[model samples]
Target: MTSRPAAPVPATAPAVPAAGRLAAGEQPVLPLSGELELRPWRLDDADAGALLAAGQDPDISHWNLFTVGSRAEARDRIARMHRRRTAGTGAVWAVAPRGGAAIGLAALNDVDPADGSAEVAYWVLPAARGGGIAVLAARRLGRWALDELGLRRLTLRHSTANPASCRVAEKAGYTYEGSLRDALAHADGRHDVHLHTLVAG
Candidate 1:
């Protein structure tokens, strides 16, 4: 019999590693200072109220484009936050004084273990504004994400119209990269966004 040529094997992409660091254990409580900490959100009335307050705040709603109509909705959102942590897609924390109610939020959204990256977001209540809480919470959370979680890069994007947020990003050790034209849509309209980044050393 005549010899036949062998067929070539098809190529395949390498498999991505799962986000074991984020999903392997319970979310941790990160302390910002003696009085403040970034802890996991609870499904209780007080935490729900914090979400409600953030939704009702004109600045937070306008910038973050988030709103909860009622306590039930807020609780649902809180539950989703917990679910995301377990799913390794996100990690969110409530910024609170020790043994007190949440007064703000800090989050690492769009967590991608394969890419080793995430985006940072945060907002503080009106009463907590102007006290550098946002900056502190952001810095603390960024440290944990980079050092503990082993993420290589973190990005922060904010509307150019919001200078306060820009300040927060700067003070939190993020380097200003550049602006993206019409990158974000706010309540007013589509706006340019400033991109800031922090890379693990």
Candidate 2:
């Protein structure tokens, strides 16, 4: 993929704990309009079903390449998210609306605290697609990463074929930078990507 230039960052991970862990008191909470909240993935009763649904979605599986095949596998994947957070590389969150199941995910990947930059991503379940949750959730996470984590910038890129994701990136305030021609190799083949970014003042 076309890598975004890094912005300078402190050489330490933010002391923010995420949801579901016992140290959740330090978890950062991001509230969105219409009552959606982004929190750390919990090892709660719903974790199995939630992650299974995500893994089973044809769209999610197609895009992610590595999808969970069982509840155990789902748990393991989430554990890796937690480990990444501890290592100060990345963080993932479950998108929870008021009185609803965690219906989507918002995350920062390839985080570089030393560079003060990260890549933001989000996805909504098929059943949840029409609600515009993706844009709101992604915007919330980007803001949190910039504000709470003291990041200098965030990059968001999507395959050129995914127009819906491009819309989400634009609406989330990431300005289109340019295209990365055949930057990523997916299950189907290499794909071009549209790169977008939002820089902190």
Candidate 3:
């Protein structure tokens, strides 16, 4: 495993409350792992903010659908992630490696409890790329969705042009479900996306 640079987060900060726990009668959100803690989003997560900023690099923005164009937008997106969790529609995880700074984010968004499924998306900072952080993070996210959230399946999609993302899905054991041609609309126009799925018992 590639050693990562030390992150700036305080080791003793209070654990953030899980989004599922925000509403009454919902299943309590459990921490997914100590190997890669799946704690709630902290308002004071300076490292997360830094990760978002790092993601705004031109290369990162080239493929990212949702771009944080400014510091204000970055703050707003973080706030919105918190709001979505409270609203019960989504949850975002800071991909923090043990004793390392937060390198990226993985999220279970577009959740549908009635269907027992959700869309999973993830990204790693430039500095954290090629270290298999995305694979580790996606595996943890899939496990938590299945074991803790009682989800039946998780789906992920990325532009067909992004083979790195496809590799991440495959590395994390998601089955290739085929592609949707001209199904995604981007600033440049329409593009194809490869869909992948992971089903759990």
Best-matching candidate per TM-score? 1
TM-scores, all models, native as reference: 0.89, 0.84, 0.77
Tens digit of per-residue lDDT, candidate 1, span 1-201: 988888878876333336776977789989887799999988884444888888889999999998987898998898899899888999899999988899999999999988888999999999989989999999999999888888889999999999999999999999999999999989999999999999888
Candidate ordering by TM-score (highest first): 1, 2, 3
lDDT of 2 by residue, 1-201 (tens): 999989887697544323322223355767889788887787662454778888788877666664777778777877888887776778888898765678899889887766677899777878889888998998888887787677888999889988888999898899999999998766688899999998875
- Residues 62-107, model 3: lDDT tens digits: 6666577555666677788877877878888777655445667788
Better of 1 and 2 by TM-score: 1
Over 4 Å off, model 1: 1-17, 45-48
Answer with 2 or 3, whichever has the higher lDDT: 2
Return model 1's CA RMSD, one decimal. 5.9
| Models ranked on lDDT | 1, 2, 3
| lDDT (Cα atoms) of all candidates against the true structure | 0.90, 0.79, 0.72
Candidate 2 residue spans exceeding 4 A from truth: 1-25, 45-48
Please report the TM-score between candidate 2 and the true structure: 0.84
